[model samples]
Target: MNKMYKVLATASILALAAMPVAANAQQLPAQAVQKGNANKQTDVKNVPATWGQITNFVHDKSDKFITVTGRGLAPTDQDEIVLAITPKTKFIDAKGKTVPLQKIIDGHKTVKAFYSPNITKSIPARGTALTLVVQDQSFSAIDGKVTEVRDGRILVKGTDVYDKHDEEIWLHFADKATIIDQNRKTIAAGDIKEGMSVRAFYGPAVAMSLPPQSGTNYVIVNTNMEDVNPGEVNELTAGTAGVITDQKDGQITVIGQPLEKGGVNYVVLSIDDKTQIVDEDGNKLTKDALKTSGHVEATYGAVMTLMYPAHTHADKIVVKKAESVKIEGTVMPSDRTSKDQVYVNVGSDDSTANDVILNISKETTIIPALGGDTALRAGTKIVAFHSPVMTKSLPGITSAEVVIVTSDKDAVQPK
Candidate 1:
């Protein structure tokens, strides 16, 4: 094998903010009709009406927030009804049409209801419909009951509602009330629309399940797609000729060139097909030769299955190409000596790259064949994928999926 080794990055892109649009506004009827009159209609009295309805249920999570738009109403004048309805509940719309409370929200405009974690809130109960008189100029109307007040949130449940204007109705709330609403909200099925924002409590249940927390956080790249190309490694003529210390099935261990002046032995393995390599005689070597010493390359990609030992140790490397991709970057010292493990510096300046400590060993090499390799350096210009590394306090995200860098002709360095 030859003594020419450079760090090839597998580029990929990741954007967690890529979420589904919430809801579209409800379309108004093409032909405008009279509200409660067929022929020459008489004006209805505008007296302050006190309508009542039930709150079926409320649901929520910590990370996601709900948005509630004000409907020109206040918390006091509006009557808050508490009621929990089941799939069998019946609802009546303004047209006196009977419908299931769970089938609304069909083509109705709905908006997100934002809430402060400190402020616990209640939403219409699931499968239930509620109605209240519109009063004041506030967009929101909350019925404050003094029975079970905790964290300043109201709870309601049971019963049906009456006197709700379809176009003028916009009630959005989350279910993470600091205090659970033993009483739920109620609703009439005919009034629900596809565009209406809802929680676990609303009629047309629009709830998405969340994946479990897997503790382990690492960079993943599909071996089939393009590799993550970090910037270029300047000072191409500064390092000593590298020597192969160990080589095995698709794995290489090289220790010779000093990363710094007197750095420790640096040994790593290229597991996938995206990892590339070349020998001292300018002979192309398979990624398997990485265990021996040579040139190599890597690419980036979107979502992939990441398997690690004990959810902490980087024992194996696996990349599954799906759709999105980005470049990943990490600055680890070659001084640290460890088998199938390396410390990465999250402080790297690669915009499209994500920095993460990586470990690749048995579980990775055990796989068949995937990804390739091409000669790359710390700063070698290359495309990459940028994803997010979630933490307890903050979130870490990359700029781009893959950082486009120079080609192979521009990546190779002097011996």
Candidate 2:
């Protein structure tokens, strides 16, 4: 059985290599595509090759050998192959961030491997993988007021978004980092001051110290405030992830869980013309869309009024897609009439009671619980995992992640 499977897998890879458009596969990861056959036992021919997205990574009961199965040899339906994982296999994420082999084995995440052109024995059936890469397209952001800026580095004092603890961090800018305004316009990093609210997107690398030292890939400096009150600055600089409760007349009420409180907390944002607004995909949003779009990630200053609920000026707002919801049931997929949004029924039977309209982003991930593409259609059983906030409409609005489409309809689906 193993020999037959190996033969089929080899043919699949060769067929993909012979395709007219195999060059596109090189974009899978930054350093994932490399060269060198190195030795006689490793080459399938003189020409080099690459392959990935292996899902099935299993070890023998006695822990001797392991097998890995993956699809889309070149992002094609005909591409399917398996690789043997030995101790020599190195595991990492798309950004070349090293990941543990045990984590890949335990989680239901996509595993991509690249064989350095020399893993074959005469034929291309299989060989020891050179490097294995895991799935990681998400980012971590830190929002706070700039405490200090010097020597091409910015120090921020704010709540850690990951742990929600009061903390401070020194951020070093990447060589190619972009320092922009809410409008994403280029600006001088030196213009940032101590009291201005700012946000920075960084990587997993961090130095262990009193206030962790790290670096940022991009930074957004909020010039909204010149100075923040010490007592109120914590609330001003703290980031909030929530759902839009009400929006009208340049005011947006977002109800999200507070860092200190477990229950939902509400904050009404006073929007001004200069307020930086954008969508989850970082697309600039108009004033109208900023209000109506229910889910958001926002940063603000102290409340301006003494009203019952109180209000504050939202320095920066991201009308984000709702995250964290396990949607399950038969799908009653609405047709793609226009390009706005799609409403798919995951409600009871065929009712719209539990159905939701989704604003899908290009960064969204869709895969089967068991792997490969599961065709989506009317009444297709599926389970979707998303995050943080959810709209309160009669049905609601949301975004999807890892949607397990049950039907074996199409071999190829959108990434």
Per residue, candidate 2 scores C-alpha lDDT tens digits across 274-390 of 788898788898777764325677776543332213367877788766535656665554553225344566644647677776565553434332222334544456655545356
Task: Residues 1-415, candidate 1: write the lDDT tens digits.
Answer: 1111122222200111121211112212123345765785544322211122222223334221111222111112112222222333234454435543334322122211111111101111011222221211111122211122123211221111221212111122222211111122333322233322222122122112111000101101111222234532222212222333345565443322333422222323334555334544546565443432232222212111111100111122222222222333443344442455433334446432334433333211111001113223333433332323332321232222222223334333447
Q: Quote the RMSD, in angstroms, for model 1.
A: 28.2
- Per-prediction TM-score, please? 0.15, 0.30
Residue 37 in model 1: lDDT = 57
User: How far is each candidate from the true structure, as Cα RMSD in Å?
Assistant: 28.2, 19.1
Best TM-score among the predictions, by candidate number: 2
Query: Which sections of candidate 1 miss by over 4 Å?
Result: 1-248, 251-276, 279-283, 287-289, 292-297, 300-303, 309-415
